[model samples]
Target: MKQAAQAREVDVLVVGAGVAGLSAATAAAWSGKSVVLIEKSDTIGGTAAIANGSIWIPNNDPAIANGFTCDLESQVRFILSECWDGFDESQKWCGVSKETFLRVDRYVKSGLRVARDLTNTRVQTFTQLDKIFKRYFFSTKDSVDSVRQALGPNHSRSDDELAKAACSSWDYHWENKFNKVPYGKHIWAAFDLRLAGKFFFSGFRKHLWHIVQNMVSIRSLSSLADQIPNLFTKFWGFGSGLILVERFRKHLDRQKVPILKRHELVAVATNGDRVTSVDVQTADRQTLTWKIRDALIIASGCFSHQLTGDGVQDSYSVKSSCVAPGNDGDAIRILKNADVQVNQNPRPVLAQTVIQLAKEKNAISHEPVFYFYGDSFFLVDRHGRRVMNEKLTYHDRAQHHVGNAEQEFLFLVCDRRFKERYWGLGIAVPFDQKHMIVGNNESTLHEEIDRELRDNDCDFRLADNFSANLRETKIAFNEFARTGDDREFGRGKNAFDVLGYMKPDRDHDAPSRSMQPLAGEELYACIYGLSTFGTHGGLVCDEDSRVLNSAGDPWNNLYAVGTCAASFLNGHYPSHGMSIGTGMVFGYLAGLHATSNTKRL
Candidate 1:
């Protein structure tokens, strides 16, 4: 045990350089407070960098600028339909509690305001998807198929093109019964269309209305051509997440704030309820102490890495995570160690279904399978029974797996045709053979699947009535293929479901573009696990983002934002960038509130 170094005082100390931490640092700096931003890793962007970088800001600036409006009550109502269960006083909205309702309301308003602020300050910019398509048009002479083939897998597409591929419409949950305003809330990082003119033509050739309609037609046709896989771009692509981080980093650089890397929070010292100082370990394991003059904002993200701890060991276990390393429940552990009470979400993980592929014969790696590219495949339980709408959003589908106790594991059973045509486990597109259990025939596939299940160390096994159940499942799937309607789960019943099935053919014989006849030979199956990009549970906090103690009181000069604080969403993920959006919103609030008070003597 080395002795701790001398204490250095700072007006503000922000843990984690992820989106939330960056936002906090930016806001604190804007407030004219001396700030120290520290990250456990060498890189800056946390999970945001690894994701699509779209932020689901209801009533966002771009939408408002385009003459779209979503009232506060409607926004709150839409959220209630997505996440909450009970009704409020009016009995029309999700009425969890007054406090909960108010919190949700605050989140909506704050998220909108933050988007506007970021845009105005040029710290971060956003663009609507409809406008992105209208601004850029591909040549009709080349045809969508020819262009896609000409530009191979490694083809360079602008960030905006990538966004268009990922999200053609913001109508993800329009099918949900309680949604009032669904189309305008979804937004992505803005790019200069002027710079992206090469891939798609620069100027609008036809009338404004005609060009817009033509763009829509082209988008639909492009979708038919399978021009894009979900949430992916070719080569070392320039994603929106990178764009978002770069802008934030530029702002921090301009502010002259120092973002110290390789600093891991080890010990936090508290004077009663207030955090007075924190001890951080350097790369060489040297401990350095920093005294907090104003506030300590923890935005280090969730505990996807930390397997066992006070708030973690007993809660639900996450099967897999794509979150950046260093999110090892450091904040929760340190806070609990210092006698602070952390809030625990019963269902904490933001769910995403993943498959564990064999990196080596003995080593396994997780690959996210958020969407099944074609309609030819179906998912089933150990008993060979369909459990969910295979077309549901990753969060929704993964939630089913997380909460379902009877189904130990689900298998994505697809034919060779389906496998060859589109992607499975999207991030690692072109699924490796090692990632799947392949069989030449039905009997072999069944045997291999059962063998894989029996060998699973993650408490998964074949059901008692596996053989009988599988035959019935196959019969049902065939019936679904014939009718083009998944009567049991409503698989292809929504706008989102239609978007996921890249048609890629003007004249196909299949009844539904989302579904096709299964190939007779060479089938594949991969075990799906309950996965998450990050968790949303942490210390409970107020609207100001101040952490609260056991008796429900704010700890002076201490704050938690992003995944460091309990998520206001409760357990719902409304759209693409909810985590990043809410994180920045609360982080901004935390930074401003934390700096409002004068420094302690």
Candidate 2:
């Protein structure tokens, strides 16, 4: 039997405790509204906690006030150049309204203010980018000199050659496997492989190391860098979702605002086109209807399998290892049922790629030869076949691959060099020689294999059929080692130059060069899947953070911020800290919008 419905009233009920939702709640509370922020999860922070905690604000933020002066117009032009397809028409003739622009501006400023207070450091958006670049890239000659000293004279040449070989191989492998595939149509399909390798090897790893070093060195500096600030301010809890939720909760607590967690919104009771009240399910399963006399704001997330059968019917499951599990998209489903239009674009804002490389060295010599399997543009197996499209939404990929590919099993066939460089030569093998093989020990590798299988809920298989796969992979690799003709995928072009330069076999005769350790004496063949940060793209909203229906009409009290909304920038251009920045800015806008509307009433 269903429980009787309860009743309550508040100025606002913000759903989802992600960074954006929390920001909205904080803004609304600060504006003196009775706010009730609800989260489906036991705690909040969302994907922001797992992230590096950088907010990419394009213009001059508080940190780099004197370091650099940015012309906003120039920066905007650069962005437009990259996103000409969408911006060319939309930006002309005042397509972006002044009201939306002002709202975005105000939101950004507010976020900066919040960041300044939390970190206790004068940091502007530009300064953050500068800090990141200086820490990671060779901005100064001294930094390059230090890298050279560590790597020795051959570092530049060696690294560049390895990159070149890898890039060439990647391109060749991708085209041979994917070009003729019907769905492989996007230009990015050709570039993704090179981009992924470059970002991981050159960008992400280097930047991460630099940031860690900066954190340690900040104390030594005489200035305010000594005070190591919280990695995430405003948001609280341990994970990404939790941190943002905590920050928002704290803000509301300070303002004496009420919050009800674990309360699920069941339905929207509407009068004509406006939402009059929302029916919610409490922890005890009792229904409670809350009246919204003035306004309503829907910050619910997108629909997932847990919320709708549509997701399950399409084989789309929630397989994110990183995102908050509670984001099943119930809120989105309810809103959609209530005649609220939703944007269901098949593309994801951010896509992830994973590659499996073999790390093994020659038996007689200690030289390493890392063998990377997978095309430059798309993640593929040894047979040179595109596994997924560069822009297929992650949901589509996850749903398609999960539980089907023996999720946990991976076989890494390697030579000796890989053992010496990455892993100390204490090799291990499993008792079942058919399924697991190591030239050395038997227990340790078995244990690792077992653990992986258990974690992914999968079974293990032998490498009996690996010979065919290896033959295909070896053909691609050997071709690059000889001719350097990457006709299949086109390696030494555009962004791929970064990867091309990392090859070990490339000629390093040039005086000015950067080298990567591509020719280390290691070769291994392994199977792995891409680890994702989180999903991007949800509700579509205007610059003012107002949720727009499919017909281009505002959904009276509906709003979205953060990952729940389509990103303003193109999907390919990944700028660090942008997601967090968007969450905070949009959250602030939604809050202000709700507050102002309430005031007028």
Regions more than 4 Å wrong, model 2: 1-7, 74-86, 89-245, 303-321, 350-380, 384-522, 530-537, 569-573, 597-601
Ten contiguous residues with the weakest lDDT in model 1: 198-207
Which tens-of-lDDT digit does each residue in 1-601 have in candidate 1?
Answer: 1111223778899999999899888888776768888898989988776565777777777777655565777777777766666655476325565445766777787787777777788897788766433222221221233223322456465544433333333445554544544456767777644323321231122123432332343324444344333222311123566667778888988887888888888888888988888888888888888888889999988876653212344333455566676676778878776555676653454444343442122222234565565666788887778888877777777766554555535788886555544443342223344456787765677788777665654556766676567667777886777787778887655545554333322234656535565746567777765556766677777767777777777789888888877776666777666788778777887787788731210
* Model 2 lDDT, full chain set: 0.41
lDDT of 2 at 466: 39
Candidate 1: C-alpha lDDT: 0.64
Q: What is the per-residue lDDT of model 2 for residues 405-505, given as tens digits with 9 covering 90 to 100?
A: 43322244433232212120101111112222233322333344445444444344434333455445445544543454443443322222222112221
Candidate 2: worst-modelled 10 consecutive residues by lDDT: 181-190
Return the TM-score for each candidate structure.
0.80, 0.57
